[model samples]
Target: MKITDDMIDYISELARLRLKDEEKESARNEMEKIINYMDTLNQLDTTGIEAMSHAFPMKNVFRKDEVRPSADRDDILLNAPDKKNGAFKVPKTFE
Candidate 1:
């Protein structure tokens, strides 16, 4: 698709960008190049290839969950500036 001045203006407005007269042409060229690259990529044949979210496989780094003894409640509460009913009391976020 051809990138026009109207498209550039609309995109800049949507993105909250204030492009100068010279910058508009630069932005339009960059956008056109990106669209052309995407079109080139779409021409590739991938009949049986499975779509993947990542280029390489990802593994969870989290340790296994295990039940364990915790510190004494009174001891933990002793350091609190303001706590009530065995829980940390914080200021109201909203009225």
Candidate 2:
């Protein structure tokens, strides 16, 4: 696909980008190169190749979810700047 000046203008408008007269040509050339590279890649044969989400295998690194003791509610409420009825009080956010 060829990148034209009109296409660049449309893309710039959609992206809310302000491309100068001098920069339009440069942007067009760069976009053309990217599209050409994608086209070249599409021409490659990938029969029997399995689809992968990443180049390397992925594993969960998070710790196991185990039940643990927590601090007292009175101890946590002591840190609050404003507390009423054992709960933190804040200004109303919505009318």
Task: Estimate the TM-score of every prediction.
Answer: 0.46, 0.46
Give the 10-residue window scoring lowest on summed lDDT in candidate 2.
35-44
What candidate 1 gets wrong by more than 4 Å, as runs, is 46-51, 54-95
Q: Write the per-residue lDDT of candidate 2 for residues 15-53, one digit (tens) a residue.
A: 999999989999999999998888987788999999999
TM-score of 2: 0.46
Q: List the residue pairs that clash in candidate 1.
A: none
**Model 1: ten consecutive residues of lowest lDDT:** 35-44
lDDT of 2 at 56: 91
Q: Which residue pairs collide, candidate 2?
A: none
**Runs of candidate 2 exceeding 4 Å displacement:** 13-16, 64-95
